[model samples]
Target chain A: MDVGPERNSLLAYARNWLVGLRSGELGVLPIIGGLLLTAVVFQSLNDNYLTPGNLVNLVSQGAAISTIAMGLVLVLLIGEIDLSVGYVSGVAAVILAQMLLPDGSDLPTGFALLAAVAAGMSIGALHGLLITKLKMPSFVVTLAGLLAWNGVVLMIIGSQGSIIIQDRAVVSLSGSYLTPDVAWAFFGILMVAYSISLVLARRNRMSRNLAVEPAALLLLRIVGLALVAGTVVSVANLSRGIPFVVVLITVLYVVLNYVLTNTRFGVWVYSIGGSIEAARRAGINTDRVRIYVFMIASSMAAIGGIILASRLRSVDSNVGGGSLLLYSIAAAVIGGTSLFGGRGSARSAILGALVIASIDNGLGLLGLGSGQKFTITGLVLLAAVAVDSLSRYGRIQAGRS
Target chain B: MTDAPLLELRGVSKNFGAVQALKDVDMTINPGEIVALVGDNGSGKSTLVKSVAGIHQVSSGAILLNGEPFAIRSPRDSADLGIQVVYQDLALADNLDVVENMFLGREQTNKLGKLDHNGMECRALEVLDQLAVTTIRSVRQPVASLSGGQRQSVAVSKAVMWSAKIVLLDEPTAALGVEQTRHVLDLVLRLGQQGLGVVLISHNLHDVFEVADRIVALRLGQKVAELDRRTATQTEVVEAITFGRVSSVPGQSGATTS
Candidate 1:
């Protein structure tokens, strides 16, 4: 297919996106807009908000919630919520801490972490079975799970104020940073891989007689992505370089995004979310998909718990308590994943996490209390939901006529 | 039309506890033929179609595909047997685009198990083009963005894409406007022309007259009359639906004929 001169321009692409937005296909526009606005406001209030060191800290601190939110995205895509995720993460952390205690079990750090993740996954599967096979509502099942898992955490942490992690490797999972050279190499590899994939996708489209994006536009996107990667790497290197947790989150984001966008399972998730009866009529194994999604959600929560423990160098009764679940859910929704399901990506979790972390960090810089931070976060989440509902309404109106 | 029937239902009966939705009903659909099942609101049209589509199991019946007994216990079983149902709702996911909805359950994947988006898009375009569906602006557009006729076209194309030999359409044009209804009726005729046996359950006698080669009328959970469209008049089909039998008097109203 010949690309017309007018259509080949970046301006044309932008206009197309605008047209889609006007028709109520909101995509990632709201999140991007919110992120930019927040950055401007926060940077104006506190110059430290935009500093390389502070930005690096924001990325590291956002890693746990961001990781957990990715799992929530999957669950949300299936039109389900895992209310127990917060407590599930707590249970995992408690187990990890107990296993790592100097006077406790002598399991290796890797084995202990694996055991914690496994426990979380098992709990998730149990929830899935109950919801799918027993025909129980996910909300009720997970709500019960929330209370039961919290009780287990209390039982495990009885009489102990906190368990300090002594394993050096476990501590480094979140506390360590990559060298500047390694960070630069990572950025270079990402750029190369991204470019190659773009070219290959274009080729595939051409071979299939499908319309391919103009070469100029494709190049423009590649360059744009590279610029973003370069800026992030440069900013991190200006400090102590990228934190290991940030790298971990980035890898998780990439993998989850690929799975959600490019795989058959991902399609099933969206289909089931869109309409369960439709999915069943299409001959999809809805029960299996729901089960796997719950498992993924809880396993991700377990990963978040491990990161939290590593960051604090200790696990306590409050490891995964105190609004962690709310924050993670808010991040997913605020990043653009529809709470109603079938309309989100792993990128939403990352973007939303960044927004939430920025708010918390900026408020901390201003010496504001947690109360103010909670109020602002709640407002932002409400605003995001409002946007989602309005856009959905608009789309429905458009479809009807 | 082929001599051998593609699908046959004998003594199909379904009971929802105290209510008998279908009782001792029989139907035979042939290849390259369009059979219209006309009925009133409570005449078991939906129940019969659902039974054939495996959404509901018949309490007692023998379903034959190619002269052999077939058991449809699930939608998957029906799909595997080349039976597809384009329900009134169309069953298209509003969030997914045309290609995604077309291949929802049976997605094509590459060697690495990733969805082969390019391949699916190519096949989707081919199928849509074959059906001459041009109203869709872009194959990537979500179903929610399409008109009623376009959504129906996608759903039908999805059924065709699965190589279905028998297609059951329940009120394919019920909620459609005049133009869209015409489009769907044309597609239904084309499906018949392509040698797929089509069972279209509709209330519109005009649509049934336009596409159906044979008309099956049902009333009170029983198949009342089977008329060849080439020989039977609209009045006769209506009589069968209302009174479960056609009046013998020519050019006489049912009241006078009785």
Candidate 2:
């Protein structure tokens, strides 16, 4: 193997993975440490914080915000933001509720869902058009959208405070769970597929004489994942089984991660985010890509809104009100997505959402109100950003090294 | 010298409002030739390159490619015509790796349309090997970490990767050290040997005279002089760049403004 002094050393690899001092990556240590730290603090306050049942409920609660944040990652990747996502999602939920109102159109659940996503897509397209064609700042355009879409929600849900969703399918979206047997089976399938791919990749590198992890280390990595997966499934069995909402969020993560890392469109999104001028010189249609990214952001927002409504079994003008939008954005940033663009992952959105949701979940158990929850969450967000900025400086120094 | 030129600019003029950036410019670049474009700052050297790259449509005249009239209305048209440019300040993204930057807009895709990473890596390796660029430690290393000369090499390699008939490099070695400058000069000569029309825009006369087959000078948006490198002296080229063949100026002292 063409192993340089630092390239093939298992110790170096592990250290780098932990701190990323020499690698430009944000690293896994801080994220894991933060999660564990949160667990410890909350568990001390309320013994229920670390329980299997509470943890499963946490995933269901985090799914919608995580999904919304995931969509925001696309926009963030290209160095933009969608302030209207919360309201866009709110509008979609209202539309879906109206479609499923039995006394009204009484549309099929699938069609109603499609319509919500479509509405989000159209709204995103509009935002893109105004931002690009009119040459308006995205901040202003999305800010206007935030207010305008909130108005749309209010107009649609006028007189009635909320549209209660009586449809079984819609309600089941957030409440449904996979049985223990099915959850375990799915976990098994995933582990098998994941292990095969990872093993084959290592073998491929070995064949090429590239530095690769030792077989023992590779096995350890696989075993580690297996343990985690086992714990999650076992916990789900202990609770009400694995929530389908969690599965949906995970599926979204997998799909988006693949798309961003492996597709032409995905590369362009990063390129545009990196430097629009450079991307333009490279013959990329920057405007078109930007528009599409916004569209994706909104479409995902629609899905998030649906999840929220499904959980509550209703939609109202206040669905996306208060700190939901800010929290969603916060979740993405806390998960490790950069605000300045050109760097982020779908994993960040979900992980960040999990962190945010945990704070809320833990606080609720202590009988704390939303005020305390918001204050703590806001402080956490600030700390995350401070670390991110510090890491950015470290990235620069690491690049020099 | 008997070969027909690959690119010809005839009386191409460009005006941005009342300010004329390029005026009545004429030039020719043939296969297996190196043309050095030299001038003071704002002397239409960049304007002419930008015009050819279709960043600014010529207000008048025509551009001929491969002896055929070619209309370049946008940068894409220029790229489609096998013309590539490595800009001075921003030819690459610092966050992306060499392979990603090299194949930014024109990524090779698989049957399912995902990035054909293996294919691209092989091709990238082949291209780097062809250029004899041994400085890069890994293709996966982000561009931000690369030395200035290494980044320049990747940018030039990107132009070569796309099968460009003509390559325009704007100040490729302005930020490099002496050794790096020598390396880039060698690469420019190598491009000429490979039968591509290479346009080297620079402020360094030593560099231009070292590799360029001919020097084209511009002054105040006009083509002032075209000289054969073998016959031309440094003074003559400098004079052409500053004075434009006019023995003396009527204005106070001979002010040479950038």
Question: For candidate 2, lDDT tens digit of each residue in B1-258?
Answer: 445589999989898887877877889999989999999998889989998998889999999987788889998899899999888885688878889999998999978997877668778988998988888988987788888899999999999999999999999999999998988889999999999999999999999999999999988787789999999999999998888843223233664532
lDDT of 1 by residue, B79-158 (tens): 89999999888899988999999999889998889889988999999998888888888999888788889999999999
DockQ, per-model, please? 0.61, 0.52
Worst 10 residues of 1 chain B by lDDT: B246-255
Q: Which stretches of candidate 1 lie over 4 Å from their true place?
A: A1-11, B15-18, B59-61, B246-258
Q: What's the true lDDT of residue B98 in model 2?
A: 89
Candidate 1 Cα deviation (angstroms), residue A298 = 0.7
Looking at model 2, the pairs that clash are none
Docking quality level of the chain pair in candidate 1: medium
Which residue ranges in model 2 land beyond 4 Å of their true spot? A1-9, A15-19, A22-24, A199-221, B15-20, B59-62, B246-258
Encode model 1's per-residue lDDT on A18-99: one tens digit a residue: 8767867787788778878888998999888999999999888888899899999999999999899899999999999899
Q: Score residue B16 of candidate 1 by CA lDDT.
A: 92
Listed per model in order, the count of residue pairs whose N, CA or C atoms clash below 3 Å is: 0, 0
Candidate 1's DockQ is: 0.61
lDDT for residue A206 in candidate 2, whole number 0-100:
65
Q: Considering summed lDDT, which 10 consecutive residues are worst modelled in model 2 chain B?
A: B246-255
lDDT string for model 2 (A235-328, tens) is: 8899899988877877888889889999988888888877788888887888998999999999999999999999989987798777789889
